[model samples]
Target chain A: MKAVTAFAPATVANVSCGFDILGFAIGDMGDRVKVSLSDQPGLRVVSITGDGGRLPLEAEKNTCTVAIQAFLDRLNANQGLDISLMKGLPLGSGMGSSAASAAAALMAVNELMGTPFTKTELVPFAMEAERVACGAAHADNVAPSILGGFVLIRDYAPLDIVKLPVPEGLYTTLIHPHIELRTADSRSVLRRQISLQDAVVQSGNIAGLISALYTSDLKLLGRSLKDVIAEPYRALLIPGFYELREAIQKAGALGSGISGSGPTLFVLSESREIAAAVAKVSEEVYAKIGLGVDVSVAEVNPIGAYVIESV
Target chain B: MKAVTAFAPATVANVSCGFDILGFAIGDMGDRVKVSLSDQPGLRVVSITGDGGRLPLEAEKNTCTVAIQAFLDRLNANQGLDISLMKGLPLGSGMGSSAASAAAALMAVNELMGTPFTKTELVPFAMEAERVACGAAHADNVAPSILGGFVLIRDYAPLDIVKLPVPEGLYTTLIHPHIELRTADSRSVLRRQISLQDAVVQSGNIAGLISALYTSDLKLLGRSLKDVIAEPYRALLIPGFYELREAIQKAGALGSGISGSGPTLFVLSESREIAAAVAKVSEEVYAKIGLGVDVSVAEVNPIGAYVIESV
Candidate 1:
């Protein structure tokens, strides 16, 4: 066996109405990882860069290395591998930085070892990798980062996942404010028990969003994708949440919501032009709020993890 | 113009997991309403029947009559309608008997008056009629009864609705127990608030159901169409809820749940034979539990609410 390296883009989970179940892949922001066969009998993470010296280099704590180890263990392969992660996206920025690294590592390792695991099989392992950092098993980020486009994790039990068709002309505007809110912290603020009435409303909203996605109606998609349960409670943690939303709405975003946990807000639009417009609008709003932010307009990347430049 | 009568089948709301937003029209159980131009101007409901003498004859209290009256009032016409309703499905009882009557009456009168309103416009009016019964404006039952097929009500503000494609080879078995549970009485048993955690799980299930339905995967449909929020709370009112579900599962129902509110249960299957098998199994179970129940196997009536003979 020889060495292999791959890259997987960052992802945005929840997608406004589909919290914990739905996600989309973003092409522009991601992480890169390299994996090489090692003579040693156990896995080892060699190095990591571009993560502000935040991510651990330990085998168990590093998301990329942990995910690769789990994937190899699942395959019952005793082979060891050395991994190097170049994290383009930052940690704790709610941009799925950990998920990207995990996906890249899993893909690189899987490919190097005769490609034993399918993308679906790699998802849970990747989520496990994410859990090393976030302290929980969740697939909203990993599913899209692995499968690409929009992915729905129907059930985790038998591992049922369904990929919904991307609505035509869908573009995204992502604004990452230079603030950090960990997924664990955001999750802790949520109430454990909610009113049954509120659950009914939230369920209705979810059904609407799924239907709108299938029907390809942008207007309905905007109207349907509402998070009465999570956004209200978590929005306070993000600075200028209301103003950014208002600006996005005014700039012709079909809909806008917090991207995953706080610090990153996303706007879904129909075209690159509108997406660019939204990016400009978001920049202005962040400026008004006295927060520095990075904005990008990316299409829904249909292809997930793959070797962009094969060695 | 001569007086005309119209009939609309009753609908089951919630349909197990899809609370406040999903419904389907059922034949052989519903309401019959007669509408005619009245001499005394404005709308007046003259008679009512088949309701065990529980329904009021006054226009203000009658749901079917109120829908027609609202339609006429919107037109600002001096003309009025005289309505006579023959209700077959019990009021509330989880079956949308009142919604059917309201939808049917409004439909028939609209035809007689040259259809002053579209089907979309008629939905809210029918929902308004439902409000007269349940004290809340909801459109799950009325939308299906009016537009037919499985309906996805995206949003109520702009009245965005999508008619989802009913999967092929789908059959249903409905078991109506000879017990009555009014919508008001059943709704009163529910708690006002719910946990956000439960909401996320239920939303995931609903998304799975939509995907399963679209893909025509019956097994996935069976697995995904689960109600975690409302079923556990409301199942207590239905006799033999446990035994009946178990029996149907044994008999080969893809899935089963409380029909709308209570006292009625619905089973989904792949074929009529399977549906009949499920019905037979449920009948024995209900009989053993000392609940007299009527069971019927029917395909999902894709064409909703049309004239049986001629227009």
Candidate 2:
């Protein structure tokens, strides 16, 4: 049997002002998938680890298998395949857990099949898994997890994704509090209609953030990392959210906000030392609130999903 | 006695996706102001031309005199000055006529004085004139008119204005169909509230437009030039608005939309040839409707307001 193992890193979506369009991959934590070619003419999920038997075991219901199925359907491949998933990110933590699994599985399957598709072409296949996991098919998380670095989904109809330039010495600290904040519950807090004034403010910040990325103006990027649309309502779902953000800012973070929906918050800093300081502050804040937390500090992942071993 | 004459070019605001935040200066048509130091102790408007006696001659009522008064107040200089206004642009044409006069006057006065403020610093003073002409003190037009090229007002509270890089070989065609469309009327058509979904789409386009500018991807820029928030309601006010836009697109123009509010339309093109073609098509479209039009094509203005003559 020919087998391939691939790993895809965790990603931070929304990035404050870029509520639904901007996201970036981070190092140190992610999901790994192993795919093997089989003589049987079907797909199967042989095993799933690190998810504590919480993830669906059935091949058709699993995000990893669903994504691989989409990719195989697109390629018209009928050969049998067995998928093994290792979830490195926590579920419902708003850290793109489902997207990581889908991306890793697609990467492994694509590599096992002689790398038929480019990394960019694999984004939509992964988005199929996103649609299965979340009601809306958003590309912010999956695109970054697949392509690495910063990704901007400019439009959805034609699915335009643009990879933005990353600045040097930029680091992120992701802190996940041990709390149950369902994505659906978090999304329900947002108002469908927003004031046009607030919309303009949000648009201005997103524009500034993009300009800051191109010019490598970290200060401007920090200033532009504000969310008026989602954060105002979503912050209420997370415990001590405002206090944690204030502490992170005081701890020398460039800016901090809810990473995706809730429970997980990403703090951006100019240097690793500041990022470490932010991590310490975040842990202290969560501990004060009697909530345990998982924290990771890493530079933005420049290389996204990659084949770890192919034999 | 010292005298200076300055010219400030007209600007196109609300560049489709970037409503109330993005604007760019254009060449050829603008307003000119001559500020001459006199022995008189108070500011006075010596002459006003080209406005057909519609503009106020009183120092406080006119945009040019009001902007100069603000500049003098900031500089703490009470030197008597005589102001001459020559309006190169039509009034309420949706082409930033008021902003041009304010910028030109400020430039002339700044040159008459020892030039204490930088071009970026002069934006707020010019906004004072905008407040007088329009109820809101908007910087989209005044900022670009004062500092050449594209300007993005990231924030209004602290007055953050970012000057974006202009792509080479980029040209614009501005067509003004003779009509009476007030800015207040244009603004009233807009809803105070907008759907969050539309806001996300608008933000994505603005971010893409900024990225397109950095990469000089004219095609992406054209694709990003879509207005969902204001264009839908405002388009009904302009005659043959959608048809004109479609014809311009077929004429090989990159993208086109309402210049500021209505009556005037601005078309962006990659080259000078395409811009000329767009201009011709725009004229023919207006001529078919029996509406006379004024059309001009020019490259983006690199140096905004400058002293045309000084003595």
List fnat, each candidate: 0.80, 0.93
Candidate 1, which segments miss by more than 4 Å at Cα?
A309-311, B1-3, B27-29, B38-40, B44-56, B84-91, B308-311
- Quality class of the docking in candidate 1, CAPRI style: medium
Per-residue lDDT of model 1, residues A1-311, tens digit only: 47788889889987777877888898767888999888897878788889778878888888887898788778777887788898888777777878899998888888888888788889989988878878777898888888888898877777788788788798988889988777677888788888776676677777777777787878777887788778888899988889888888888888888888867888899889999999998888888888899998899888888865435
lDDT for B295 (candidate 1): 83
* Clashes within 3 Å, all models in order: 8, 0
Return the lDDT, model 1, position B254: 88
Interface RMSD of each: 1.7, 0.4
CA-based DockQ, model 1:
0.68
The weakest ten consecutive residues by lDDT in model 2 chain B span: B254-263
The top-ranked prediction according to DockQ is 2
> Which run of 10 residues does model 2 chain A get worst, by summed lDDT?
A254-263
Candidate 1, residue A266: how far the Cα is off, in Å: 0.9
**Candidate 1: clashing pairs of residues:** A193-B195, A194-B193, A194-B194, A194-B195, A195-B193, A195-B194, A196-B193, A196-B194
Task: Look at candidate 2 and tell me the lDDT of residue A140.
Answer: 93
TM-score on 0 to 1 scale for chain A of candidate 1: 0.95
